[model samples]
Target: MPSAPSVRSPLLDRFGRVHTDLRLSLTDRCNLRCAYCMPAEGLDWLPRTELLTDDEVVRLVRIGTMRLGITEVRLTGGEPLLRRGLPGLVARLSALTPAPELSLTTNGIGLARCATALREAGLSRLNVSLDTLRPERFAEITRRDRLADVLEGLRAARAAGLAPVKVNAVPVRGVNDDEIPDLVAFAVEHGYRMRFIESMPLDAQGAWDRDRMVTAEEILDRIGERFALTPIGREGNAPAEEWWIEGTDSVVGVIASVTRPFCGTCDRVRITADGQLRNCLFATEESDLRGLLRGGADDAAIEAAWRASMAGKGPGHAIDSAGFRRPARPMSAIGG
Candidate 1:
């Protein structure tokens, strides 16, 4: 028997979780070929006709924020920077009457050129994926030699007044695990927040092994050796468990999605670049919002579609359950 839904909103799930954060993937094309993310070559890009136009994105954001009470919206991508007219899209989203807070997650390769513009267009913050600080290791991990470009982009993001600039690193065991200390040092030196994430099963190659993951405890134990860590009580629905380094005011966070999943408190929903609504990152099924949009459906119809999809969200992603299977699409296709 399920509990009653929230009278205040329709976004509330059966478990009483109110979905507020929306991760919208702007594109499914990336410039780099990270080994864990996608293949080195021969990837088929989504047809331009299928992608949601900037106007379409703005329309959905309006419906989400105004009708559904979504409070925060994070723009993501294969690489969001790859999308044209993105700042304009940001401006439109920021103009909503009760505009939801807007942020972006990027590979940081193109920020150096557009960080100032993005900030001016009303992007509030940024999370850049930076797996390794070593130039050689960076090249090895991403299969790209643009580490210096990414570093410059991080600096540009900070200089452009993007508050709380954070770096997200997915440290694999025996891959970039040894560079955690150095990565921490780099983040501290640059006054950026650092978040270490346990590698998930979203890899393109489908070769992820649970035993190979560097668990949250392992990350904390390793970093604790260099700096005294004081755990900070995480706020509601935040996936990361943050800590403050003793003596240094800088903070670090670990998103232990694999070891200790936060699906119970997850307040997020994702919309793929192709306009599919996903209730969970590892959701086996998707609801097609594109059909509603393209079929001349009204706002009410779109909202109804959203509510219907979210109503079916399960207790968790079931990654730890027996006979668990990975989603058909990889992280790049699913939007990180």
Candidate 2:
């Protein structure tokens, strides 16, 4: 390997954004096969040896926190709950000096059983993916009949003190877009923050088409017809543009990642389950952090490799451009 840099720099990309958040995927294996995420048959699971051990994950997170100035961490997965002893991982992360504001993004399938345990272990927040409110539509979109379980999980999360729980909805043009008002109502009634995200090109089945994506503008327009929404500005590095309801304290957000990319202010990076570090979710290339971790390299060398990867990050993901191409890995493998 080339000589290490004289000093380890913070994870700053060429765009001048200092990254403080890291999305760490514990496993690429999920329980539900959402239509936009994977095929009905599911994916071939990775071998046990290929995944980073719990120790390795904690070590990398410590390096990111101590050496690179990352102050936030989100544990994601094909389904993070699928990983064994996840609470233990959360406890270790919570014990870090200046412990990161830790969170998790899940499908809410398994959360009902372990929500209390995870909260007790120091998990602070959660974002659950729920596309449709109707049971039939949920089954149709996700190819799973576990909407009841998901609802139970949401309640469990709230009861466990995971406050300000958020719901992430990806509205497809002809799919769940019609349920926007209903979804908003559900979120408002349940005291959950709902954000509509435009569908991106990360499906494992390669079925994403621009014509089928429900844009953020369309979502806001539809919601406006039903509710009085006043535009509200969001705080630092938040991917959503929020709006507060006129009379009520309820609020909604829209993540226009496709129509209006937030790459300029993106303070986030992702590490895949196998240890590949990606500066952007739609990146066509990934740096192999697993290799260095298992090759007897010290923390400094690993940090250098991470810095090298972020140094080349592009200005934007360019999803609306003609030259755009979807990544080989799907959203599940890349984490939420």
Candidate 3:
């Protein structure tokens, strides 16, 4: 077992970036098989015994918030809603001292049923993945005919008062690219903030191609044709470049991870469901926190290990570089 450092500090990389946001994956088991994320047949899910218990999760998060300087916690997953006792987990994380702001990103399959429970349990925000407006197109992209369920989930999230319900849409060039305008319109109509993300290279099949991605410029142009867009610029460490939809008070955002990488100001770090810490989303390397957590390591030791992992973070994901390589784990396994 490693001993704790004499002095502790915030999670900082060598490049001078301070990580305050934690994307904690509840489970790697998702209900949907989105083409960009998972295979149609689904994945070989992690064994139940391998996953961090609810108690283990709370302990790590406590260490992150009380010891380190984590101010925000985003619950993510293959689908967070699939995690049993989610409301209880959120309540526990919310009760932390210093109390990190809590949010969740989910496929929205079962959100309609539990959005209120989650909100009452202290979840403050939500981001639901809805790739297209058309049911057939949605089925085509996700390989599941559950568009109605997702839409209802969004509505339920709104009803539960999870304000500014953000909708995340990934516009694949030949697939849902044409629905960009409609997607934005739907968001605006329903008082949801729409976010368009470029298709990344994290696809399980390793079939991502730059040419096949609908660039940010193209996405803005598509929305521009119908709605007037005024730039709202970007806020601190946020991955999205937002814009006001001119007439309405609502805003739309685009996460151009490929065309416009924001690694320089990144303050986010991720922990996969099975307890591996990833300094970067596109990282090919990971540090095992599970071993330490289960092997009787002290809290200070865990914090020290976390700091060491971030120390090795590179300048960026380097997707545009010719030498760039996709991570061994797909988006589903790694946590979106």
Candidate 4:
């Protein structure tokens, strides 16, 4: 017999935005501490007991799709591949009906080893974070020298047929800003979509000296000097503003979350490692869904909590407010 339709309320949020893309943080652990995400010293990670079990994550995802209209599921973390047996988790998440898009965001340190199994387990695409191509610069930025391993992972991802692999870069002025043309050229040559991200004040170590930020406008201008950028219309409330450089089947994107806020078109809801439903990246608040889930809250209740949080999502973050602070926790704790 076919399953009964859930008796939940309408899926559209108060913003009239339906929650379609869910960014699930599988683990708080990271192998590298990028300057933008965590403190230089270290941070106290959450106790194991606080994290949701794999089964708990799947249960929440089912409710999100069944009652809340979530259609895209992106697994993220400090580094999701750092989590053990993620292919199993991916396989389990892939089996959910309504069939949301399945993908992952990784630092690519371990992806070299796991890409094949993960692809077989049903991951559809990947966004790999690669800031600098120069091995020495990479070591300086991430405090680790594994650029070769990450390169192998990118190749493995392509070989495994991961479509539209995105390379995300956090452009810190004077640090790696000189490489825009080279980076764009590299992406075009490699058939990878490259995204230039403005450094936001997400953590203390990122230091986020406003002067050091290379805005999207500058990035585009520099690229425009080299290649003609034809803006492409985005689909279904997507995040990045895409522009294709003429004469190639390649496109470079700029995420203007910092310089040009796109909150009105925002359709993302983040689930932290501990299962708190966060509406905006800069929000000082978090709703504890894991408490209710582990405390015997049914799937419907979980769905309702997520709906309310998304419904309550602010039109945008208040980075300009007098009291606005970079969130107290590092990006690692918050799930970058």
Q: lDDT per prediction?
A: 0.88, 0.91, 0.91, 0.82
- Compute each candidate's TM-score over C-alphas: 0.96, 0.97, 0.97, 0.95
- Cα error, residue 71 of model 2, in Å, equals 0.7
Q: Write the per-residue lDDT of candidate 1 for residues 226-301, one digit (tens) a residue.
A: 8889989577888899999888869999999988899899999999999999999999899988888888888877
- Clash pairs, candidate 4, are none
Ranking by lDDT: 3, 2, 1, 4
lDDT of 3 by residue, 27-126 (tens): 9899888887777899899998998899889988988887788899999988889999999999999998778999999989999999999999999999
The list of candidate 2 runs beyond 4 A from truth reads: 1-9
Off by over 4 Å in 4: 1-5, 8-10, 204-206
Weakest 10 consecutive residues, lDDT, candidate 4? 1-10
Clashing pairs in 1: none
Query: In angstroms, how far off is 188's CA in candidate 1?
Result: 0.9
Over the stretch 81-131, how does candidate 2's per-residue lDDT look in tens digits? 999999999999999876888999999998899999999999999999999
Query: Candidate 4's residue-wise lDDT over 18-126, tens digit each?
Result: 6578888988888887776665565677788888889888888888777777889999987888777799998998999866789999999878788889989999999
**How much is 239 displaced in model 1, in angstroms?**
0.9
Specify the poorest-scoring 10-residue window by lDDT in model 2: 1-10
The window of 10 residues in a row where model 3 has the poorest summed lDDT is 1-10
